[model samples]
Target: MSAADTTTPTKVPLPRQAPPPTAPITPPGRRTSGGATVPWALLAPCLLILALVLGYPLVRLVTLSFQEFGQSQLWGFKPAESVGFDNFAEVLGDGEFWAVVVRTVVFAAACVLFTMVVGMLVALLLQRVSGWVKTLINIALVASWGMPIIVATTVFKWLFDSDYGIFNALLSKLPGVDMIGHNWFASGPEGLAVITLLVVWGAVPFVVITLSAGLTQVPKELEEAARLDGAGAWGVFRYVTLPILKPIVVMLTTLSVIWDMGVFPQVFVMRNGHPEAEFQLLTTYSYDKAFVVNDYAQGSAIALLTVVLLLGVIGVYMRQMLKIGEVE
Candidate 1:
């Protein structure tokens, strides 16, 4: 065989190497399916638990709220007599109920605002201090937070009690002879004030801890640069620290509102929402309806209403937080 005849034929392109056996082109949907199934599988148990615990109860509560309960209906198993919104109408028509709602809103607002302010102040003070002072403050705040709610309520009740209260004792020594042992719980506004003070005192510690952690995250370099640029301490805080702290502040405020709206222990212990239900907030009202009045249906409705109000507030806050240029 001559060289030319024996040589393998000159190499051909071979149809462009068949495009290098390109990887099996997965459909977009199929790719999504592959990555998504694992997460869905893992989340199934959580979803199931949530449905069983939260979703079912919520549905049941709504259903029960529409039903009528009587003394004979001890188990509440009898088919719910269609009340046709009578329960809601009756609740809305009641002047006392509306007053309680308004009072709750005002109380919650006051508590949240005062708690945030006091928390921020305490946090800033701690930031500037060192050594034993900071440690002591932190310990006191944590101790208050760690105390059982029932214990705290009992202590506050005793402290504020009119008969043998330390408060009344001190006031009596202040030369107020006319009403030395005046019944604090008998007065509506006074009872409400006591509740507000207790709520504020209990919640401030949480706000302080959250804000202090947020304050520490403020960049030292930014603060220093601001100072170098002739910014005062207040200016540095306003321009640098506050903008970063906005989210935390908003979050803390929202949480405070939620906590105060559902306030129960203080009012329950202080006077059991007494003096014509003077210190009754939404949670106390619900408790009275459910347990005291033996009207779980009405109580569930009130509870649901509270939940809705909270959700509405949260939604508004989120909208404000998410809006561009709103934080600054």
Candidate 2:
């Protein structure tokens, strides 16, 4: 062994194992190389249904708005004649139409403001509750949200009915109040107030539930730190909580505005296309002119205008919210 080349035994290096075959890299949500295909295939049916139900009607309505779609055309076995922008011109020329548009804008603003404020309070309160209390409140809110719009409108109409209504009965009980024979439905302003009440009441439940869910995702440690720094309840919420909740609040507010602006059931039940033209909203007005007055083209034009206005308003809101978020 000591001799230079005599009997030296060499240790053999173990055969280098190829790095364990790298597991085929897959993108999240994909089970295979063709993962995206199946999901899209599954979604195709829903998309087709939506196109048939929503897209077709929207296109038809838009086309109808540009035609002379009077009752004769609507009923007769003939297509409507293209009248260009005549229906829009007539609708836009009416000063009364503009008034309703302005009134709808104002009404929507008020409803959104009311809904957001109450919803914010309810969401904040929910944060402080626990266990069964929270569960019970959630159940109540869900029930209210699940209620049908038409049924809710009927309940509200009955409550505010001039004769044998619970609301008037309560008003009559007030000190020195002679509201027993009061006709709340006869007055436009008062009637509008009832509609607003209905809108706000029905909307707040949704706002509260959505906002509460958002609040749960907020980091509690941040809130506790703010409190530890001698920040009062209002200070903590205004400076810490609200900043985190801004996106949710903005989203809910935008939805509320859209819903209230296009509200129909409550207005229909309360006003029913009466002489109180002052209380009419876009939806009710459009329905009246289209169905009640038998002018489909005019109604479609108004509806198209409503869609345009809603889109514009929502776009502005989203832009503003995004800018504010970026600045903060």
Over 4 Å off in model 2, which ranges?
1-33, 77-79, 272-275, 317-328
> What is candidate 1's CA lDDT for residue 157?
84
- Give per-model CA RMSD: 7.6, 4.7
What is the C-alpha local distance difference test score of each model? 0.82, 0.86
Question: Candidate 2's residue-wise lDDT over 1-328, tens digit each?
Answer: 4587696689999998788677877878867758668888999999999999999889988998999988678778677799999999999999989999988988899899999999999998988888799899889988888999888888887887777789889988889887766777676777777888889889999899898889888898998999999999999989988988888887888888788889987887666545368788898889878888889889999999999999987998889798887888
lDDT of 1 by residue, 104-125 (tens): 9999998988898899899989
Q: Report model 1's TM-score to 2 decimal places.
A: 0.81
How many residue pairs clash in all the candidates, one count each? Answer: 0, 0
RMSD of 1: 7.6
